[model samples]
Target: MKWVLPSLLFSLFFFFLNCTDVDYNEKSVNRTSRKILIDASHDGGVWWSPQSGTYSASLPHQGKLMADFLRSYGFTVDELPSFSVITDSILQQYDKVIRAGCFGTYQPSELQAYVNYTNRPTSLFLIGEYLNPAQIDQLAENLGIHFQGIYYGNLDTYAPHIITDSATSFYYNAGSIIVNAGTNPAIIPLGWLDGDNNKPSLGILQHPFSKILFIGDINGIESLPQPLTLKIFKWLFG
Candidate 1:
């Protein structure tokens, strides 16, 4: 709640940047060119913090990294506002919608809009600390996805982890999932809250969509190296 001012400011700034000169029609009509929208707007809290303070909401690195990665991937990558503004018209233009970083406190209308987007046959890559209970439930209600609560201080205890489950194929050496470059049906488990915290795991989902690969807790904004990010961009839209 206290981070409202900077978060709103950042969101407004993002909305204007995309709305002002972005020829959505032109971008959408490029049938051969795949498009992906990276929601790098960081208005959420950190691992230990419950709310991202006003001063900490300006996470421009997320936009910078994702845009570069998608571009390299040969996809027409556009950084969208929060999922709240993602309407049918907007959804038609992009192939994948990546919720990068924290999905913090957004307006009710925006949340409703995002829920509708999830209902359709679309792809969403939710990274980092996901969101709170209400937003998580909204995704499940619309897209049939749900997150398990994270154990408190699990990250500290289980340092450098990796996922070896057959259902969830990952490539990283540490964390719950690995970062393989294959087209496998995987859900990269990212964040988790304590039983008492009970928000949602970053990688759990009810819908078993193909290509649902999650690279657990790797803050594409804070962690991914710039070069690897470029590779990801090239793979998406470049």
Candidate 2:
């Protein structure tokens, strides 16, 4: 958790850039009662320390800011310390879910539980890392999407969707791209890596009663433009 001057300053630049999104929290507070579960159970590092809200000012603390953003929007944010079975008792509680990382394998019933949950009107957001993505890909495969490739820097393409409106200039510390696996009617590309529509940096899977948005980047959440992040939450829980 230590930092040198130049490297610290560089990270700080993106930190403040992302922190500016904290204002979006004030923009809309107590707006709705939508509930969200940030599945940090798999040892996901995308969320904050809970103890350190957005005030920590460190780059990683930006995850805390994301939680604050949700709170400001009047959504109840919950954390899952384990990805065991994802029983209906737990899945039924939240209107939306965001899974940012996974270190271990997922239970077969858990994947089926998610599939069952999506049979209703719900939304799920997935963030992928450039490093080991076996577990992430496994879950994604069950959901009809795939994460592939590895790279760092700008995503290089965008869609006309509201989500992409605020993510025009998204640059990442590191990330991956979603592979184009045949033609799944339910899947739509939200953003691409270098103008290749087949490979996406951001994609969404449309289910009968649910939608799953996948971000092919580890730092995608923390590094996402504030406006873009705000729009995504609003669209998901709003």
Candidate 3:
């Protein structure tokens, strides 16, 4: 009986170890197989041309850089030039959606569709720049956030977040300010401009099964280090 009890204890220990290993391996596989969608449509405003009426038929460098970064971490990335291609069926295929520098007005149905998608297991990263107040307000209302269309500049530094470094001095050509709307528990601030009375430069809304990360400026991603970028991806993807 003494030997039997010792043997049973040993077996239980080994079983627990095996279960832990399986869980870790499963999480690693999920991260490796994760797919991301980068939306460069809606006048991303990441690239500019000095010559009048000259446009390049190329994806925005910001989107390309972000895609490349995510790809390096074993993530599959898809770049879309227009949100029109996104449907409920299509949105289900991606684990995350990143809309960088978006300034286009969305229809009510389109906004509702996106809201529905966020309510699922899918995550979203909304990057904005220089949008009109009305457009910002509309988006804020739809997403249960408070966004003001005001450019913040001449800033010596910024608040740190999952992606931003505390020591980094940040400046934006045109950046919006976000505040807590108090409508939902999911909506919360992630980062903010320095010395702006805690006005959020980056916000996150954690829905029931999904999440949304909002950045006031897309340029912030361009300046982030690879380590910080990876951290951001981990936060968004996980």
Candidate 4:
């Protein structure tokens, strides 16, 4: 297997970015272990993109890493195969739901199920392209959260192994994020097209959000040493 970028660096990037001198209630942030659900189901069990390759490979490699990492961070993690099967009753039991950026469309009922889940006060980590913009907007509005970026057709930033385009960068960048408008603005601004030539490329919006963490790029989580990922699991879950 070819490791395009060391997963250790990627993990660290997220950890440090979230560890600045922000006045988060250390006690509150470190409360009891939160239940975290990893959503990996896609419509038709595949992701569709104009780019190329099989849909099975479109899922984020970081999902497993993130789950294990979060587990180390004092949180309980579970890989959910089908979002449709995860009913509202099951969702309400968890504290956090990390959306692994599914690239396919959802059945009307499935979308509605997500609606019910977001209505309550549950922390959500959305990674990847926001499929079905309409449903996304509805959920965002309900949650009083807003994420910038207009989707232009389909830009697949994964195949070429370059962060210069959405088509490739999105393989890693396609995950959902925490968009805090009042406190942390959109830092590490990402788009399918670079402004000058409009060519595809990965860009970071440099605004900090929630506490001191940057939304666009998670430096610490992405760059942590392999051992550290386990350390993070312990921190978040222990």
List, in order, the clash count of every candidate structure: 31, 0, 0, 68
Compared with the true structure, all predictions reach lDDT values of 0.42, 0.67, 0.62, 0.41
Candidate that scores best on TM-score: 2
Error of 2 at 120 (Å): 1.0
Clashing pairs in 2: none
Q: Which candidate would rank higher by lDDT, 1 or 3?
A: 3
lDDT of 4 by residue, 54-158 (tens): 323234543345555565545666766533455667676765665544444555665666666655544454443433445453333333444444333322322
Q: Where does candidate 4 stray beyond 4 Å?
A: 1-28, 43-62, 82-84, 130-238
Give the per-residue lDDT digits (tens) of candidate 2, residues 112-186. 777777888788887766645443566777887766656776776778897777566667556766665456777
In what order do the candidates fall by TM-score, top score first? 2, 3, 1, 4
Name the lDDT value of residue 217 in candidate 2.
72
How well does candidate 3 score on lDDT at residue 121? 76
Higher-lDDT candidate among 2 and 3? 2
- Residue-level lDDT of model 1, residues 1-238, one tens digit each, is 8899999999999999888663322332234547677664442432213323332222443345545644554566666443235455765565577665444444565556666565656566655443333544233323334432222233211112232211221222122222221222333333332321232233434343322323334342344443333333233223
lDDT of 4 at 169: 22
Ranking by lDDT: 2, 3, 1, 4
Which portions of model 2 show Cα errors greater than 4 Å?
1-32, 43-62, 82-85, 131-136, 196-198
